[model samples]
Target: MKIFKKSDIILIFAVLFVAGIIFAISSLEKGPPVAHIIVGGEEYKAVNLVDIPEKQVFILETHPETIIVCEKGCAYFSSAGCPDKICVKTGRLTKKGDTAVCLPAGVVLTIEGGEYDAVTY
Candidate 1:
């Protein structure tokens, strides 16, 4: 028995072609890297990662206390007040669309504006 029939192969190729086109368009629209800090569901600050002159740390207004650090072209949660500390474990947010969230503190740090190649399972 044939593994992939003629129609099946054609459909697979067509899907890949459309995916490539969408990826290309999305890549072309990317901008410079930026990090946005949100507190209590509101945007607290937006930092241009590419324009950072030096490493910086910020303490947000949250219970338990949360800290974020940014340098060069990346940002990350250095510390979090939540017991889980999952946000701190998230490491660096170097790529666009990367996010670190501390649920208890109501804080989120996300990277915005940059090219993302692909996400693999």
Candidate 2:
């Protein structure tokens, strides 16, 4: 058997490293492309969240005291008479399974879909 040179070993490792990174990036790009926004038990279907326009806002009126505005995958309690602004502090939600809840206002924001056919839990 022939002896392996140091340069050959280094070259092999570099190629393996680049291959791993390419695999990871491709896998990340192949997942589902839907975001589910739920407010007061109602679900809104949004596709390709990154493509949402900056100024396009959605208003959700769950109750007289609860009003939410969602624009570009970010949601906040624009107007709420609730005692706590917990929902507002929850910040923007973009990933699947993320949620924001306002107990007093009875509103819930959630993201769904990940190797599952339907949204549950």
Candidate 3:
């Protein structure tokens, strides 16, 4: 049996258009500049990616040091002691609230005050 009528379809379209507008407006807004580094599930450090004029790297104190690279308002795993190197492959995180993790090394990097957070749905 047909469930949606003509008016129902138009209403759905209108709702979707409004939602699209809201999403776009929110996406265009800026977010916090801070980035946080966690090692062994603990708060390790916080940094402002925007403040660094040049590229920087850090070695986390893990079983083997975890190397992280910060550049151009983004951070990524340039290299890691983890055997799989999966974290290194996670790629760049530029937007606020972006995250990269190395479970084997107990390391996590997340952008603070990101524009959007993970939604359960």
Candidate 4:
């Protein structure tokens, strides 16, 4: 007859628990790659998100008459001659769903995320 000790079972469980914790920590350490898109009448792909500095000022020059300044992860239409200037009031956008639309200049800014190799494909 084979006998199993309580200490042995506890040791096995503890080892498994520690392994699980380690795996979870490693997975959490991985972050999603960033993406950037310049939205106009159609979606125009921009350079990788890494190219854009975070929490910094950026100027986006569009055709016609419009300029955008992105700061602190949010971009707003700072200057525009559009009749409505609605894009200016749209304010800054930060999250993935956030967007800035410049109707007059026919420009838009959007952010998206997907599995990327950090290299242009």
TM-score of each: 0.72, 0.50, 0.66, 0.47
Q: What tens-digit string does per-residue lDDT give for candidate 4 at 1-121? A: 4576888899999999999997565444322333244646655544344456654433545655666665433455676777887877887654454566776577876544432344564
Model 4 local distance difference test score: 0.57
TM-score of 3: 0.66
* Ranking of candidates on lDDT, top first: 1, 3, 2, 4
lDDT of 2 by residue, 58-120 (tens): 465555465555565444556666677787777766555566787775677655433232334
lDDT of 4 at 114: 38
lDDT of each: 0.87, 0.59, 0.78, 0.57
In model 4, where is the ten-residue run with the lowest total lDDT? 26-35
In candidate 2, which residue pairs clash? none
Clash numbers, per candidate: 0, 0, 0, 0
Total clashing pairs in model 2: 0
lDDT of 2: 0.59
Where in model 2 is the C-alpha error above 4 Å? 1-35, 44-48, 114-121
What does each candidate score in C-alpha RMSD? 7.6, 12.7, 8.8, 14.3
Residue 84 error for model 2, in Å?
1.0
Who wins the TM-score comparison?
1
Of 1 and 2, the candidate ranking higher by TM-score: 1
lDDT of 2 at 55: 41
